[model samples]
Target chain A: MPTIIEKIFQMHTEDKVEAGNTIWLNIDLRTARDFAGAKVVKNLLKHYSSEYIEDATKTFFTFDCNAPANTIEYANNQQICREFARKNGIKVYDVGRGIGSHVVIEEGLAYPGITAVGTDSHFNILGSVGAFGQGMGDIDIAFVFKTGKTWFEVPETVKVNFIGTPSAPWSAKDLALLCVKELRRKVLGRAIEFYGEIVDELSLAGRITLASMVTEMGGIIGFIPPNREVINFYSKRSGKEIKPVYADDATYEKEIDIDVSNLEPLIALPPSPSNVKRVRDVHDIKVDSVFIGSCTNGRVEDMQAVAKILKGKKIAENITLKVVPATREVWREMMNGEIMKELFNAGAIISHSACAGCASGQIGMTGEGEVQVSTSNRNFKGKQGAGDTYLASPETAAASALTGYITGVDEI
Target chain B: MKVKGRVWKIEKDGKLMDDIDTDMIYHNKYLHITEQEEMAKYAFSNLEGWQDFPEKARKGDIIFAGENFGCGSSRQHAVDCFIALGINAIVAKSFGAIYKRNAINSGLAVLECNALDMAEVETGDEIEIDFETGEIKKNGICILKAKPMNKIQYAIYLAGNLFRYAEGI
Candidate 1:
């Protein structure tokens, strides 16, 4: 009668734990990004007074946010992480490696049944592959670095069933947006286990797109139990048999059914990710730029979606289309395929694999009075820039880039 | 333990504001500042109508916000900025999961009072909170009640922070 998360917790704690119980569980993988890596190191040394870490092999420093050091402050912070990792014999995924969460997944550092923690708020994206991933502050991450253990209040699980297949132009991002709109604030502080036919048929990239926005919905993590494809991918990558955890007679706090047959491509309006609207409902809104990247929808599948829409077509004259792959691996994959050529020919500014629009000083930063369409999560005021941001799928972003306005794929 | 302080209600349109995200509390542009004092200067700088919170706030003042306060990002600076401002406690309908943990780990007082918004209270109202009994008293009259800190929260609070609690253990 244990859910997937409960089983994962039991594996880490070696005890039966229930929801609402706060218990300490051993951490399998710990990471800090450039944004807070320096503070984590400083706090760890200040408290422990030694260069000793609990497990150097399990610890890593990832440089993705503000990759390549846009400013002197970011440069100094990345240097601090490099120095600490050098002294501790820890691995560092240097700049241009892309988002830390995606890097970990591609490297097989995070997989099904494992528990990983990072400084990124979207680290819960690991749930796409059935891993228990959490984001913490620098202080909490520092403690985990020293102890390799952290206490967590087991969140009650909510089962969300995605029924029916979404037609063309309506992709995982649209489904995710619909979920956010329908289940706003209801999943707060709880875990969501996505089930049903749509979830089972969804690809790894699709699962990631859905799980990445769980944070925007105020949920702890959104888990899509590792399907056969995910299990096979990990087994092949790790050169070992991978066992996927499944909920057996597990009871959930609540269950919600979302039918996508009648759903259209959706977009999150400015100021909040949950403030969603159908793409057609708000069409023709002039857009200054469109960004296709970030941990949310920067995978190869997302690139393919964009390429499919913009193949042999040039974007609008006044529109700035920025294309950033999620990871170096994704970038390499795009380079070997027609994705890059199509995007380049489409007049898109292909940037290095880094968090572009999501973080400041990147290629996707919006100017005042500008309206941008982004594939990344979160569009709160001043998040991308002083301008307004509309969160959409790669398909919508590509379509909008071509028209210089917010346009659904079907409209074009 | 009892905490008495003036209230700073985070409100909009005559109602408590909900979803006061971390970016609103501490904008991402100033994420590089690691010092608590430096973080204090930018508290609520991105939030509309509260851009001058850092300058107008007084020490030992308590904040009242609506549901899901501190909802975005896991940046501890959001909690640190308030602490740097010498805030007594933050009473909200609820808090973001990571934000709540960051608050407790940093030894900042965060209470959940569902009725705080409905109570007859306004900014500058004097209120006393009894940590032991989860009581909120305004002018010696019980107006609302909040969820007191749990065992782990109280222990960490008493010990100053997670690091101190770990040392004592």
Candidate 2:
């Protein structure tokens, strides 16, 4: 009778808990990133001087927001993190390792029924693989580092069923955008459990693409019960059998059903990720740049989709197409395949695996008066840059790059 | 449990603004600064029309916003900037999940008033909030009702922060 999140919480706590009850739960994995890693360490030292952390083995520092230290400030911050991790005997996934959340997944640090907390707002992406992930502030993360636990209120869960399959040119990003549009502000401060045949058919990458955008909907976390593909991935990595967790016979606060059959490639306009519109309605908007990577859509399958569209085709002149793989593992996989060559031949500037445009000073930051079509989540003003950003799928970004305009995949 | 302060209504076109994201409250470009005093100057630096907030805000000022205030990013700077500016409390129709938790854990007061949009409150108006009774009074007159902090949030607020609360426990 417990939802996935509730069940995960029960596993971590000694007493039974329900919605609206705030209780402390033991943490399995605690992580911080370059963006706030130094602050976390500073806070930890400020409050608890030189005290041994609760569990150094479960703690990690990942540097991906500004990989390779673009600015002096970032370099100093990364140095602080490294120094602290060295002294504390904690792991540090340094620069070029890609986004911290994706690294957690690739390294198999998080699994089903586990609780992970980090300094990233999108750490809830772990929910795609059926883990309970929450992003907290530096102060809270520091406390978690010191105590190996944090207090959380169990949120009521809403069940969302995705019925019917989306055809070609309508990728996982499109489905995610449609979900954001339909469920905007409705799932605020609540957990969401994704269901239906469409969810079952989605690959692990596809599931990640959908679960990552749950933040835009103001959701606490969106869980897609670990599918067979997710279980197999973790089992092979750990060399142990993985058990799947499901929300069997669980009660929900609300239920929403979305039919993906009629959905088309969609784009989120500037200033808001929920400001969604069909690609056909606002086609041919001249784009200055196209960013084809981020935690949201930087998997190998996303790269393959872009490669298939841009093969033997040159991108439009004056259009800078920036491609970034999600992690070193994804980058290595692309290098061994033809995806790298296809994107390179199409004149895309393939940079190191990192959060390119999502974070400041990265490769894909747009200048003032520039228009960028990005695969990353969140196009909020002053986020990617002063320029306006439209969120789209990999196929749409590749197609738009070819024509120097916001063109849908169907048109190309 | 009573807080009285001048109001700073976050609005546009004569209506309360919704979805005021963290980027608008404290832009990412200023994320490097960890000091509370340095962060104060950049509050609302990226928001359109509110870029001068840091200049106008005074100590003990309260902010009134529409639904989903502090919507995007889990950046604690958004909450820290307001605290740096000496804001006493924030009353909104709703708030982002992470933003709400960040505020409570950081010892900042946040109240939810569903009738805030309909309340007759304006910038510079002096209002008093009674957390014990969920009463909101403007100029000594009861004007609206707000949802007070929950048990955990009030406990954290009393203890200064999550760290101090844990120490006592």
Candidate 3:
């Protein structure tokens, strides 16, 4: 018998025809962000006369630019989206202070065992919470815009069994980078099922950090089933009492495990998400900029870690350090606490919560000659604004900002 | 897994600030800058060995770039460039995820090698690739170290997509 992932593939491969087989798994949840809306709306306006979209109910929209009052258009565009959703009766959520799309959704939206489709490539970051979430193009999404149904070819499942407690500053991001390095780029878009005792120890935020980067490894998604940690997470934010979603016990194409207990803070050099080495390996490499934000590592927990490291210290004079929160809610929490002040006092510019410098959205660009070390998932050269980009965990990126060289926080 | 293919030529790591090369992968007479045949003949435009490349260059083409090999939109034209031109594979030091995914889904191979050299490869040298195994050997030299594919990626390659399942895993 094939594993659950194999079952998904068999079903999609057979065109959803085989008995007990389904070719495409139905998506339980769908999400879209502002970056994709302009294109999506234009395409719809061009393709259809009156503006009809499929599957609007199963989808949700959230705005991330409320806090900084970033752009006049930011608030205006969100109002338009909210109005459209309200008029169409599509579910829209903000929790007032909702921030990043992935963070807000996993905070309360995703149901276990559900397949999620999003317009952005990084939406699969929620798989760490045990959901099969992935990305699609806006045009295909237009169909989902019209029907709320997404097509899948059922991917083969690669089982990643993680064991051993991860070393300090060496959290899920380390393992994720390792996967990207060892697995090569071809394995992308494959289902990744993360298991092992260590998975249980990671906070829900940590899992999001790990799952967010699964796309770095060329896998379709990365998932660890919901446990008490997740339950605790949901218990706080939601009263709807959504249930846990788990994959069928049987059927996986292959299983791979990692013992992160001994892992160190790893970093990916410029031009490749997979070209990674321990912080020690690149200690001597000089740095020009350091960034600690984005859906992958911009959560409150990550910000606290940064604050802990930068509280009394200032970043290197030549290096520019910046931070952005995962969501406005996270930003609010940080502002209420000492971390926000500490970061600003230490000379770190606070970018708004709207994916600043993460995707193409906004903020940070490379000059004629510049190198930036960041905690974002992709390090493909010039990924940030322009210039060279080096991928690192939050701790490493923070430390590099302090010394203007890649190093661990302890060294700073 | 990583597969080594000679780069037909590099496209762009960062968006080319000055010049806009159109006949990159697809043949569009609509652009009217050059004939589709001429573009293919001189394709990859000013890209080293790009124009000289046949309709399909084989594996072992080294794609060296400053940064961001596959940046812009996800148009499978680059993948189609390899497929239609019969280029065997591509080995860039880095690649865009969308480009890498599209290449794999389409059976065109691309590998990431920060140190790979197109200068070392003789054009049309018999390149070896085992996509299932992730092995790349060019002219008797084993260059890349490939890892195993995950379940879904393997199935996509084997079944040739969810639409056609000629073989079972």
Candidate 4:
């Protein structure tokens, strides 16, 4: 009677509650980014001393949210966070695997089935690995830090069933973007669980993108149950024991499916993550800025994929392309592979290690009249700059940078 | 402990009552607000009116709100700032997950109905909220029904969230 999500939650909870219906969880782990965590830590420590906090050990942290160009903010936040972690004996991983807190928790030896919560909306990305995670407020997160457990009102789960295989160059990001557009701003507060055949083929990265995009749907994170792929990822990467978790066939409260093979590369136009269209539809839309970063597209392949497109091509003279690798390790790998150089030759301004050029105009500042085609997720108003942003795959980002217009991955 | 007061001010539109810019909160170009709790009490950290926030806000202090009261980044500092500053239950048209959850979990009240009058309730106006049942009163009269928290969230609120709800606080 154990549903897939229940099993994952139970990995940490073990038997805190039954798995048949819905359940609230005792969180084993929690995290916050630079933007929120910095502020929360400031307030949490303001009047009440840290000595009063009883469960600091269960709390963890990473440097994201306003990480600087060259990501200097990484070190800045690290110093404050490292002190907090060392003082509390919390495992601080800001040294090398520093990136989005949620991404690292799953990829960086954080176990599966343990409950995780973070301040970032897409913290639900942990769902790709069967972790019961969600975006919460700082007060709640502070409460989580003060206690190892977090209380939740169980939400009605929306089972997103994936039917056919995804065609070439089409990925889970495509489906998530499409879902965001289809669902619009109305589906907020819903948790999406991707189930079915394509779920089997989904890579951890794909599932993460799918779940991460739930923030765009005005919903919390999306999730996929732990399958062999997740198991293999943990065994090989985390050096931790990861057990398989499955959902009962009929336990899903609802179902939604996407024929993966039928999907083409897609893009989300300016103003929102839901303003999506087929990449082919916007290929000719002119662009002046192309950004590829943020936790959404900061992974290795998203960067490398864009690099492959910019290979041997010069960037458009007037276009400004900003390529920021999501993590230090990703940056190191790209440097070793000369992906960074190829991007630079193509006129892309490579930024320091952080979620650069993605938002707040710190690193990749676009102008008033410019049009940006970003690979990073979300195309909200003035997301990257005070200009237009068109979201697309990295391949499309590169093509847009080269030709000064959005283009499908294959067409380029 | 319950000093019934009327709403001082509320912003109904999604726009900020004050202009928000990086120069006020962030000390550096990096995307982080300074650790100064006083500075980050509100999302628009360095606005003119922030300093005008009253300390030890009384009960019945009409808490006006805007649409999607907790939109933008998921920072809880905004909530703590308002809580620390002593604003009572909010009367916003909408609230984000984090804000709504936190307000409920922390035992603060928010009424989402009648957004316009909710916005109309100004500071110094008398207001009252019954936590056990979602009830709202404005100017010595019951004006609306506050959106009730579901049983689970309400439980967390009653227990003061996970930390207090734990075996021992």
Candidate 5:
């Protein structure tokens, strides 16, 4: 019996397949960001005519990675994307619209049982909705645009089962950081399927955060099978009848059990996402900035956590907190609710909806000799401009904002 | 594709660095530059290998790397920069998934040999990779055997790229 991931591959290829078998399957949704989309468009035009695009509506282009056109070079790329979108009849999410990878899910373009590919590696985030989402390079994406098919090797499945309930200060970010620590490179050439009661009870935001961080462990995708909650959410948002796919009992390559109750609010120190530490153990590392959003932790629930921590309070005078919503829908919801107001009242610098400061420090950049604790996925040196970055949960980022240093919710 | 070339390994204090990420392959500062021709100048600009590589590297030079090569953002620049430098192939212990796909789709030869030992390979070591035969030889002696590509991957490589392969079909 095949796992859920193996089932997905079998259904797509219409053949019995297992690990290490190469098969070419049709792609459902194809996406690209401004930086990569521009190149994909150029390559497509160079090879085939615009009419060669099998279905323009099936493709999406978004200007999110370097939103607001931080530099002239990026602006030029955005212009290229806008022109290509117009020329090819493809849908375009303009700057400040959304993160391309996350918006695809919210807009119902990615759903259960379908396969998706994007130009950015975090496309695996769509697995939260039970879709088989994988990231490919722009060249391969351009090829998909032409052929609507790509090949992949079936990977072994790693089953991670969460056993206990999670408490405050410990959310999906902590679980994801811990997963990165434990799995590490062991997930190479494999897929991670999350199961057990704890995962089913987790909120949609939590699931998305977990699904988005699989790449840190070198897994192709981190998937939560379409439980009732997932099916209900996607069916409501997409207006489609979503169905669940189940893996056979005792059908995984390896099984690991985790007790969520034993987990702590975790933080990944600088230079690597897997360099995790409990937030309580590290203290008084004075922070010059706090960026509280990215695809990893930019959902509405994260905002609510930030509001709960910073309401009726001001941030540390020495620290500048930047809050960036993941998508336009999230941005609007936060604006209408109390989250945005509370963040602004607390002196948090709110940026536009996009990967503004996460990837390249387009908006709230760090300074020389400065230290920042962000909720973004990567903390690689110079990942977000100068200085150092630490990855933490949204709650930890909020609590750290109150002080001018790294402090967990317990400390606050 | 068969590539025979001298191998170059990036090392620090005679130690092979594992998990050489894409940020080191091509820095983020050069990410905005879209011209493939302009990318070689910045290849390995931050990594310990060959700061003057753009001026010195030949068309068929192979890069030997440790585990998780190109393990970072799914930037095609990481693969494209090497293509621009005329790097014929890269043999690593492993690859970040996206980088491997990008390399194959762009017609750059890459292989995975779990037995790849950087300690045994030195700079300017004459190495030959026959993707068709799944063999890698160092100094005319067979040192490792790479995982052979599947038919579809070889088809793409044979046609020079995915786009061209699709056109031929």
Candidate 6:
């Protein structure tokens, strides 16, 4: 019996997909964003021509990163992408279209049992939908474009069982942080198959958030095996019947169990996502800005969570609160509902749904010596301009916005 | 493939740098810059004590790093920036998965060596590496032997890159 990943690979490769065996499989989907897709498209057209593109429709391009073109060079790069997409008939998501990863799922490009590759490392987010999302280099992506297939070294699979459900204020982000801490920064190049009650109970947004952070753990994929919840979720959106895959009882190489019953809201301190700490212990740390968006937590559920905390109340006067929805779909949903109104009325600067101001500071930059609590995946030094960033869930980020400090939702 | 060069030990405030993510090598602020040749100018621009690296680094120089080097972001520029700097190879205790893959695919030599004793080798120490056999010599002394790349990786490296390697296939 093989793990879910192995099983998927076997089906794609039509051979026994053993760990460390390199085999090529036809790619179901190829994704790229403006940040890296510019180079990928250039390389593809320059070295390999239209003939190299196996199927233009299978290739999806997006201009989410650095959207709105912060610089002239980026604008030029976006033009290059547009020209390439036009020539190849590839689907291109322009500025404010939303993140490529989210769009892939929303458009039903990714679904259960499919193998997809992307230029961004966080493509693993698609794994939450039971698709095999692997991040490949630009050359690899170009090759995949040129030839509708790519090779892979079957990775060892690790079983990650989330034993219990998370209570309020403790969303999937907190649960992911806990798993990251417990994994001890040694999960590099492994497929972490998340299962058990906690994963099955998490919403699609929560599952996507959980899978997005697997990059921080150095894992190739954070797979939540398909259950009825995710199957129905994808089927409802894609309007296609789907079959989910699960691992056998003894398929995984190693097992790690996480009990979320007592898990509290957590935050990854600046410079590294693995530097996690309990939210209550870091109350002394004040924040100058609060960002409630990113590929990780910029979803409808995350927006709803933040709005629930900020509704009927204003944020702290000293700090700025910025909300960027992950996609236009998410943004429209929030706007059509009360989330957008609650956020804006509560003093939040709700920016357009783009990758604005998360790491590049295209929209919201932290001032010198300032601190921030963000829901973004990365908190590396100066990631969001020249400030110390603390990574938290949307709930914590909203609660912190209320007090202008790194406070938990319960504290508010 | 083999490389001979001087080791540029990246340190700041008297502590060896660890987990130097791709952002530190090349920031997203410069992601818009498409030309790889021009990227070397901003190499280590965000990293402390290394902003002036482009001016100091020489062709065929090796970067010595601690665990999880080149972590974060699947930016090819992170690997390409070093190539622009004419970095011969990178010897670290470990490397981020994406960086390692990009490095190999781009024909940039990267080897995992456990004997990255910062105390044993000072900054600017001359080192020699045999990538095929995973041998490392510091100041003409064989200090460590890293695990050699598997057959597929070696073939890819020898062919100068993945594209060239795939051409023959």
Winning candidate number (lDDT):
1
Give me the displacement of residue A303 in model 4, in angstroms: 2.1
Worst 10 residues of 3 chain B by lDDT: B27-36
TM-score of chain A of each: 0.98, 0.98, 0.87, 0.87, 0.96, 0.96
For candidate 2, what is the DockQ-based docking class? high
Put down candidate 3 lDDT per residue, A165-214, tens digits, no spaces. Answer: 76565766777787777665445446777778877778877888888777
Which parts of model 3 have CA positions greater than 4 angstroms off? A1-22, A63-100, A166-169, A247-249, B1-169
lDDT of 4 by residue, A1-412 (tens): 5455555655555345442233546776677666566545554675255533546555667655455424555456546666666767766545334456444654543456667777766676677777767777666676667655665544445677667766576766677787877664445555667777866777766676676677666555566777787788788887877765556664655566666677788888776666788887664577877788776777777777777888898988787777777667777888898788888887778766565655453465777878888766666554566678777777777777777777776765
Displacement of the residue B75 alpha carbon in candidate 3, Å: 8.1
Model 6: colliding residue pairs: none
Q: After superposing candidate 5 on the true structure, give the runs of residues whose Cα lies further than 4 Å from its correct spot.
A: A49-51, A166-168, B48-51
Candidate 2 or 4, higher DockQ? Answer: 2
Candidate 2 C-alpha error for residue A349, in Å: 0.6
For model 6, how does the per-residue alpha-carbon lDDT over A16-127 read when each residue is reduced to its tens digit? Answer: 5898887887788988888877888777766653534789889988778777887787888888888888877888888888888889898888999998988887888888
DockQ of each: 0.84, 0.81, 0.07, 0.29, 0.70, 0.67
Q: List the residue pairs that clash in candidate 2.
A: none
TM-score of candidate 1 to 2 decimals: 0.99
Q: Decide which is better by DockQ, 3 or 4.
A: 4
How far residue B85's Cα lies from its native spot in candidate 1, in Å, is 0.7
> In model 2, what lDDT does residue A395 have?
92
Candidate ranking under lDDT, highest first, comes to: 1, 2, 6, 5, 4, 3
Q: Tens-digit lDDT track for model 1 on B1-169?
A: 8999999999999899999999999998898888888899899999999999999999999999999999989999999999999999999999999999999999999999888777898899999998767899999998988998888788888898899898887
In model 5, what are the clashing residue pairs, if there are any? none
RMSD of every candidate to native, in Å, equals: 1.1, 1.1, 8.9, 5.2, 1.8, 1.9
- Stretches of candidate 1 off by over 4 Å are A14-16
Worst 10 residues of 4 chain A by lDDT: A13-22
How far residue A359's Cα lies from its native spot in candidate 4, in Å, is: 5.4
Kindly list the per-residue Cα lDDT of model 2 for residues A1-412, writing each as its tens digit: 8888888899899856799898889899999999888889888888986756888899999888888888899899999999988888999999988889999988888888799999888999998999989999898899999998888988999999888876655888998999999998899999999998888888999999999999998899999988788999998875656776788899899899988878899999998999999998995599999999998999999999999999999999999999999999999999999999999999999989888788884795789999999999999998999899999999999999998989998887
